[model samples]
Target: MPASRNKKNLQVQRSDHTTIWYTVSGPAEGPTLVLIHGWACNRGDFDAVTDHLPANYRVLAIDLAEHGESRSTRDVWTMEEFARDVAAVLEAESVDTAVVAGHSLGGAVAVEVGRLLPDNVSHVVALDSLTYLSLFPAQSQEQTAAMVHMFREDFAAGVRGLVEGGSPAGFDSALKNSYFEKMVAVRQPAGLRSIEGLVHWDMDAALRETKQPITVFAVRAFATQEAIDRYGDRFDIVLVDLGSHHFPVEAPEGTAKLLASVTTE
Candidate 1:
């Protein structure tokens, strides 16, 4: 009829200074699945997996502040800020008792959302994420300044370098291009550098709280058996060996099957 009203037709709103863009799919009367994308990525990351879910399950993916079709502000973007935006979207949608699915940076936000809405969030799924990232800081003040300067001048290049190189075991060429394109589209020059301002937060205790049932589908490179055992108390951690960090892009069937088990079972 009207192009079937794809996500392109969805609306967006500003909540407490952050802009959240979201789209809904599947049966209206079903448990909601709220998705959050990693840094520099958008809701479209979940396009493949959502379709494999049972028809009765509804899917929702949101753009974190400063990423995708959202707002970029002067303030730093903390995990807490990301969580607050998701909580606001939940309120706006009148959604209650949803399963949260997140990737990379989005995984951290999902943890915060679980903490924020303990009663309403039933479960969480973190894919190819970390409690601490693989990136490092410069050893000297001068180096730090250069890092910030480079980011300010060409934010896209800075992000590209991180994604296309030095990323131990996350993605290959095609998947890397897909992820990079999203980052280039969503990230702003000055604000992209704000990552330096965002403190390195440790969520071990927060994750261990295990407010509700949780699961993790991590990349083999980062999600070592040791790490899994350590975090297993909070989540039924599982690792996939086939794909790099961008497992969803290359191994959609496998990823979808894992999520479907938790969602349907």
Candidate 2:
């Protein structure tokens, strides 16, 4: 186990009628590293990663609205709104410049963060994210409906499919069950609606608007060749032999090293 570090829980009120919760660690004056958890995940996902990060790097792990400790009454669940949740935390922390790193859906939020605060966010990092061709690119109406229908009809099954899809062959069934249970129990309405929002997000437009050096640490087993070929010129996709889509939790030391590599560069 990694040594424990002191963390401060904080909240920021957003203009969009949401209160965002986040955790701050490391030195106060160190270079900022904003950590955004993926859909259905909370800031605790990065606790081990933070422990492995350099002592001089300031870390902010955020729980987006309606996830974890964060609460919101807003109805809009767009990727841009998720980015605003992050922006609220950055504003509260007074982060002048930082490398914004996110996992899964949070990866899209990181890109929007770069777009929202072009001057403050210097680099964007994605952990096993932004590789799904169906989700990232604009999907046809029928395609979007079909994807959303799965979650609407059987939420638990939809969550299970996500875990199974991300896991490699011979992966532990126990871990898969654990992931499925946790994700299936996500705060309702928001959990289902967020998936809808992700399906409709236009990654091509977001990429065009957000101009930042992006480094995607994609899992070798989950990432598709088509996704790599399409976004190859746009992003620095580094194929990692990590555990799975949730590799950040499974391999915190390796994840920290990947995030640190970009921060130091």
Candidate 3:
């Protein structure tokens, strides 16, 4: 394993009255790589991945408001609002340009971030995200209602269902349980509201407005043909054999390589 470098933790306040927490590492002059963690996950998820990245790449791992060390009192937990949290961090760090990469829900937020700051964001990368039909493509009112109803009725069961749904066949039972426990324990109100926000998010509209090149590293097991057909022309969907939806955690070096591939191009 590559030796990890020193990381500087920082915080910035966004216009929406949310405090954003982030970590910075690597060379100051290196090309910036902004990492966004998945729903209910914090920036710490990328700690090992950052170590595997080239020392010349400036890395910024951010905690979306109400996730990780960041906190927010705002009622709106939409993807656009989450993107604003990222935008605020970039502004605070004075990052002129970057390759914004996100996992799961963070992937939707990355697209929003690119849309929100087209001038500053050169490329948008999605890791095991945006491939799930239920989570992307803007759900119908009836679909959204049913999904939200399930979560509202039994949040723990709903979260466990999500974990089970994402885990590949024959995956380690212990690992699956660990993931379930962490995700199920997400901070209240934000956790539930964020799911609601994702269900209601208009990904098609966002894609139409955002003009950045999107590279999706989708887990082969979960990459549906419908999603590929719908987004194939728009996004470069690369089917990967990495472990589960949380491949970055399981294969940080491979994930780092995928992320670095676009940054160098």
201 Cα displacement, candidate 3 (Å): 0.4
lDDT of 1: 0.67
lDDT of 3: 0.93
Backbone clashes under 3 angstroms, per model: 1, 0, 0
111-143 in candidate 3: lDDT tens per residue?
Answer: 999999989999999999887888787999999
TM-scores for candidates 1 onward, in order: 0.79, 0.98, 0.98
Best by lDDT: 3
Residue 178 alpha-carbon offset, candidate 3, angstroms: 1.0
State the lDDT of candidate 2 residue by residue for 1-265, as single tens digits.
6777788998988876788999999887999999999888888889999999998899999999899999998999999999998988898888999999999999999999999999999999988889888777779999999999999999988888899988999998998888887888889789999999999999899999888999999999877889999999999999999797899989999999999999999
Clashing residue pairs, backbone N/CA/C < 3 A, model 2: none
Query: Which residue segments of model 3 deviate by more than 4 Å?
Result: none
lDDT pick, better of 2 and 3: 3
Ranking of predictions according to lDDT: 3, 2, 1
Runs of candidate 1 exceeding 4 Å displacement: 1-9, 131-158, 164-174, 189-194, 197-199, 208-210
Cα lDDT of all candidates, in order?
0.67, 0.91, 0.93
